[model samples]
Target chain A: MRFIDDFRNAEHVKALAGSIERRAAQAGRPLRFMEVCGGHTMAIHRFGLPQLLPESVELLSGPGCPVCVTPTTYIDRAIELGRDGALLTTFGDLYRVPGSERSVEGASAAGLLEALVVYSPRDALRAAQDSHDREVVFLAIGFETTAPTVAATLLEAKRLGLRNFRVLSGHKTMPRALRALLEAPEVAIDGFILPGHVCTITGARPFTFIPDEFGVPCCVTGFEPADILASIEKLTELCGPGRRPALENAYRRAVRPDGNEKALALLERVMVPVDAQWRGIGHIPGSGLDLGPQWLEFRVEPPDPERPSAEYSACRCGDVLRGLIKPAECSLFGEVCTPDSPVGPCMVSSEGSCAAHFKYGSQTFTAGLAEIAENGKGY
Target chain B: MTEKTIKLGHGSGGSLTRALIEETLLRYFDSPLLAGLPDSAKVQLQGVPAAFTTDTYVVDPLFFPGGDIGKLAVYGTVNDLAVVGAIPRFISCALIIEEGLPQSDLRTILSSMRQAADHAGTEVVTGDTKVVPRGKADSIFINTAGIGAFRPESALPDAEMKAGDVVLVSGPIGDHGAAVLSAREGLNLDSAILSDCAPVTEVAQAILAGARRTSFLRDVTRGGLVTILNEAVGGAPLGLLLREQDIPVRPGVRSICELLGLDPFYLACEGRVAAVIDAESAPIVVEAVRRTPAGQDATIIGEATAEYAGEIVIETAFGTHRLVQMLSGEQLPRIC
Candidate 1:
């Protein structure tokens, strides 16, 4: 906890918060910063950072939760394979996410599929190795932080000549997604709080475009409270009057300018970028990673295209993910959708914007607001 | 549609397990004692009140750092009795052994149980054993039923907690959970982590002695500290406000939790107890607990409140408040 505890110091956090408040006041205008990682979103809520921020500064949660961004098509295909006698293995977060008709957990509960929750891609590989007769499909999800491990697993499967092992990848890259967010005309984001873990693998170079092309100051920040406060202060300074937008690494302890060379090489060797369909935002060109030609045989694709996909018609998860609306604005938010019985991906993934808001924000903020109204004081 | 079947979540002791109990088992066993749903049931035997509790051990990898399944069975039952302000006296153990289990393994397990019971100052006086087909069961499973004399002056009911009660945990959270997980995953965290799997009878006794009136006392077992608090506040006009920074989690356990994408609040602690006492008596209770071996790390973690009645919330280290809901299912690792 050496490195972690240092960034979570209460004294340092208070100092950073004071500086951020002063800087925001000096800017003399509303500023909106978007954090483009589910981890960052969770951290902001977990630390209750929003309450500490100046009223004029708004933080938008981007479409960064991999499970939330993964379209229903991927889950449907995975379920179909699961029902067809394949031993489906997936990360825990994906198990509860609803597909077109049913979630993998619902399918497993109903005895249609034999799904297993695994800690790593290697666990899936071990399952495939253990059960030689059944095909094992690992649901590959997440951004750069997870892609390299899946790539290495595929290489190991090849080295072992394991024919039963396969992957249904909905893997996405962070840079293109960030670029897509920037290209949106409706969003008025002033700066970006980049993902630290993702940057640890892909480096800060991929995010330099945000500052250079969009004139949006970007800071690769860690997840701790002080790290986030420090990053916000840095972004405020960068976006100050007469200051040029630049990409900075606030999480220099973990991330570097060039990133992890070995992880990048592994990902490049095993996968290629493709046009992937995001749940709310439609298709983002070259945002998705698919298996390369060498690993194509291990890819599991949907068996049918004509099948009608089930939709949660009343859910406003797409709008929520895009920061077009808050989770409270969704009609079905706490009533029809909850963590126990989530109607959409946003409520299913632990890091999903809706889940974070519902779990941490809605009730607490409302109660705090009521207290403030009664006492004429701010918390 | 797939046919419904049993899953691992059923045994996780979280919301899912509670649902299973309410939907299936509770219907058939609707006695007043069972309905109370205390860790141990109070029974009147010939006009004298006694505590009766039963628990089954089904932990994977029978042997783990600090303790094994047999030790856990003994300590788990003894702790359950102790938390209810009972002087644990006797226990009955029932063993279900698979056909192919080695004699040496069985001997080791039995000896461990004997040592644990002796350490707790309790006697496993009566026992039964049964053998099953090789594939019918795991290597071994032990079920223990304990009987203890109730300390009438110190008895703390499960629903006795009130607003302004201070919550204190006997030691660091998640050590037992992390240790077990490490042993299962072969993570080599054994160098830094060890299971806090022991009886906390002495700590419970000291807490009862120090507090003028003990509102609640529960061993943080399967469902962990948060789950226990959630259960304690369920349907009651009470709320628990815990301080995240005040919660003592071992550095090794914290690292393991980070590695597994788990919250230590929901991790099981076999040896730890979560108690609620009146605000005025909190200082005395903490002093008394700190003097005991099992409670040396004890600290006041939170206080009960009327705000957000029937809810559990935590003031995070960042000075923000967040609701701590009972975990719905198993804590599985995330891809990220």
Candidate 2:
């Protein structure tokens, strides 16, 4: 009980909450803050951190969730495999996501799905070997933190000569998304709460450009409230009066500025950069990873595309991802688009700024947070 | 239409997607629930309801072992309202479709949603739809808002937990999350693994028959039963205890989690709940669930303690004690 309770030093959060309010009050201006990890989005929502903060301090979501940013084509390809009797495997979080008109779960219910919700690609390889009679297609989706595991899976699959397996990859890099996000027209982001897991894999080099080029402060923090508070303090220091943007690491317990060399090495060996489309953000150059030509044997063709009879309009999700508008401000927020029938990418992913705000009431304290964090889902 | 490779626009809510929804969606889920042309539905509530419950589903791969998004949505909303002793009546489905998606698949998914709604005895009633540019959306995303009827005598309180109560689960723990994880993560265990995403209204009503002995009831969603248990027992004068062996887990789920270095307790569960019953009526309450289809797999997993008020502990297989914390973020693909 003590160990379980130790993880939550709620009292510290309470104290920090008071201090943050005091600091924001003294500044008398709306304080802008962004939590750059999808996990943080969920944590803040789950813990109701937005409710805990003062009206002047605005907490915004950034482009963080890999699942949220992954393009529909990758999912459609995975869904196609599921429809074709191929045993499609992926993270469980993807199972409920609707592909076009339905999700992998809906696809499975109709006898057109072989989607398995997996924890790692290593498990996918093992499944391929076990189900020797059927093809196990791994739907690889993640940022750099998870790509190495896919690499290891492929190496092991080849080592064992598993002939009944293939992969549909949409693994992406983090730096590109961050750069694109900074240029989005939705909100004027003052600072960033960099992802801790991605940093553990790619290191600080990928993010240094943010501060150097954009003049915005970025802090890498752990999931704990203390870690988040410490990161916030670091942001205030870098962005305060006469302060310039900079990169600071608050998660020193695990993340090193240099990152894991061996993981990066594996990534370079197995994959290469490809022009990828994010679910909300448009085509970001060199933002995604694809299997090297040598690794083509690991990939199989995906499902057929269902082209819209007419040109589709801008979903507004792109604007939302870039912090363009509040979910309610959107034409199709709660009125026409609930999670059951999401119309844009922002509502599709739980970590998406619009979806997070819609699911949990985060707009209550956001008013006094003027010009600081203006948009919930900006383009 | 000749078979061709799928493009991202299929999910977009344009002409092609409309074809899928109209042609295929109307075929199965042709009911009033999914027929709505608005973002959200406005219902009369049929005479002033006391509580409002909204839930959203964003499972990846969208489809997995047992059920797909269609059934998951229906059951998810039904279970959400049912946990509070409400019989889910009216519901709405909101969809976000990625552009360049296929029509054939949409038809398939809509049909499945209809089937799930039929099984759960709920109506779709109203829904919304939107289309994003090709890269602006995933295949599809569904959010469900359900309004239901809760009997005045059977209201489930948010913070009504008390001490000396017994905790009961409808069925095996972690199977739904683990099954999904195995299929998604590709752990590939020899054992068959399927998600437990059934509607539990029947079982819930059975428990409510003796609701007087119950202090609090909550569905084990998102963060799972440990999360609910932690929240239920915490800030109260009682502690909860569970015998690890008493918590049922399937062979494939255990193997998948063990192989992946994950724990089964933190995974999501769609068709289960943790009901705190008076210690004397625990067995009778368990029997009530045993008689129902959804609760046939139910078991008494833990009990509340007077000591260490507001903490959950599990007696491990090693005869040692360890505390169970609420899931921090998401257990991700580990669900069975």
Candidate 3:
């Protein structure tokens, strides 16, 4: 509660909003910043941070949600493992993620397979240890924030000599994906609100490329409202026409400049970067993580390639992830594709841009926002 | 195509479960009493007005901090009857025990059930038990059907809701959910947070006694406060605007929700009651509820609104409105 309550203090948030408004006035230009973390996206919408920002400042969500950006092919592979009688275990976020034909949850619902939602990789390891007769496949899907734990779990599995334990990994790195978003012609991002959780592992250096290469201001941000507002305030100050681009660590309390060395070492030992397929974005070099040579035996891959892939031709999730369009810009966002029956991964994952927008951003009370800002009390 | 079968989400008390009852179950059982779909069905037994309800408990882990499944089974049914303005009198319990369950554990659960019934001032009149193979069931499952006599001038209907009505919640939300989840996952959250799995009969009775016009009353169980409100507003040309800061959530529960990236509003509460009272008697009802120990934390969370008909929205701490949709699928832990 220390960090949460203090950070969400209405007085502090109002002060930061005042500072951001002043900075926005001084900049005299539209501030288009992309929040490159799904946590940031969710916090922005959940806390209604957009309403606090000045009219000139706009925040766009990037490919931040790990479950949303995961290619359906990986989900297909995990579902296939479940169908092959493997007791599949995965993060709860991936349990309902549609995988081409169906999800692991759908398979379990149909009585075709067994799947469990585990909070961490260690739980999946425990499941494997508990079930001796059935093969337990951990569907590993996440960004750097989760990769170290998966690496440690894999090492533990090897140490225990568990023959039934395996992992279907869809782990991905962030810096490369951020670069891909920048290189696109349609996206015109001026600054970035970096993912604080990932930076706690990979550190601030990995994201310096955004400023050095593309002249975009970057701020590693936390999930709290004040943390995000402070990051936006800093980004606003640095994004003025005459100002030079810079990388600021707004979430220095949690993240270090160099990151967690022990976790990085674990990732280096057990995992290797590979060209991976993203859901909306195409394959990116060295973006995905796969088991290293020593850990190959613990890996699970799709048995066949000619399986059904996701039918997402109508879903503008790609545009939404790239900051090219809002979720409402898509035809199937709220009507046909909703949280109940999601048509794409964006609508499925709570952290996905579309889902966040749909869940919290679809409606706003104009009177409430103006009234609160005027009184300086309601917030 | 995969054949449809029951999924875990169907038991989550969210939209899927709502659909299961409204779309599938209702189609087969074509009775007006069942069609109303209140927590308890209104009925007349031998020329006396009565309320009847049934619920099944299959909570995993059987035991948790503050309360276990047995206490939950009894309190859940009794609360259902109490919310419908009924004084619970009799309850029928059925147990499905799995083989290999320890006798000591069974005795402990059974004793807890008896104690809970005693505390609620209800009697377990009839019961049944069956044993299944070791893998057929999780430790034990309990189902309970309750019957209560409706007091004269105590029938609260859903349509009684209107704009300007006050919504009050009895104590904090998400305690039971956060307690159970942290206990199951070994999250070691602040130990002060415990399951609020007590009977809401006292709180409900307080509202009925004090408020001149109590429009709606529901024990916030599965799907948390938001889901219950959505159900409360079903097909009614009314909206609810809840002040996010006004809703009571314990610090420990809020911390756990923050850690898991889950919304506390969507978390379940086994003992909390959400009620709508007429605008004139709202303050009187709150004062009356606060006099009771169980309702000490009771306060006005929101009010029914004419704007955004057929919807519920929460005004965030920043004073921006966010549409509160029914719990879709399940509130799963996020993959950070």
**Candidate number achieving the greatest DockQ relative to the actual structure:** 3
- When 2 and 3 are scored with TM-score, the better candidate is 3
Candidate 1 per-residue lDDT, tens place, B89-178, comes to 999999999999999999999999999999998999999999999989999989999999977666454447778889989999988888
Q: Tell me the number of clashing residue pairs for each predicted model.
A: 2, 104, 0
Candidate 3 backbone overlaps, count:
0
Docking class of 1: medium
lDDT of 1 by residue, A1-379 (tens): 7878888787888788889999998888898888888888888887778877888887888888998988888898899998899999999999978888788988898888899889899999999999997899999988999999999999999999999999998898889987887788887788889998999999999999998899899899888888888889999988788889999889998999999999999999999887788877777778888899888889987323233335588888877777777787788887788876788778889989888887775445544747744743211
For all candidates in order, the CA lDDT equals 0.85, 0.70, 0.86
lDDT of 2: 0.70
Which lDDT tens digits does candidate 3 get at residues A228-330? Answer: 9999999999987689999999998999999999999999999998878888776777888888889978998632223333657898888888988878678
Question: Judged by lDDT against the true structure, how good is candidate 3?
Answer: 0.86
DockQ list for all candidates? 0.57, 0.10, 0.67
Tens-place lDDT per residue, model 2, B100-153, is 768776777788888878888888999999888887777887888777776766
Please report how far candidate 3 places residue A89 from its true position, in Å. 1.2
- What residue pairs clash in candidate 1, if any at all? A110-B2, A110-B3
Computed on C-alpha atoms, the DockQ of candidate 2 is 0.10
Q: Could you give the interface RMSD of each candidate, to one decimal?
A: 2.2, 13.3, 1.6
Interface RMSD in angstroms for candidate 1 = 2.2
Error of 2 at B63 (Å): 26
Order of quality (TM-score)? 3, 1, 2
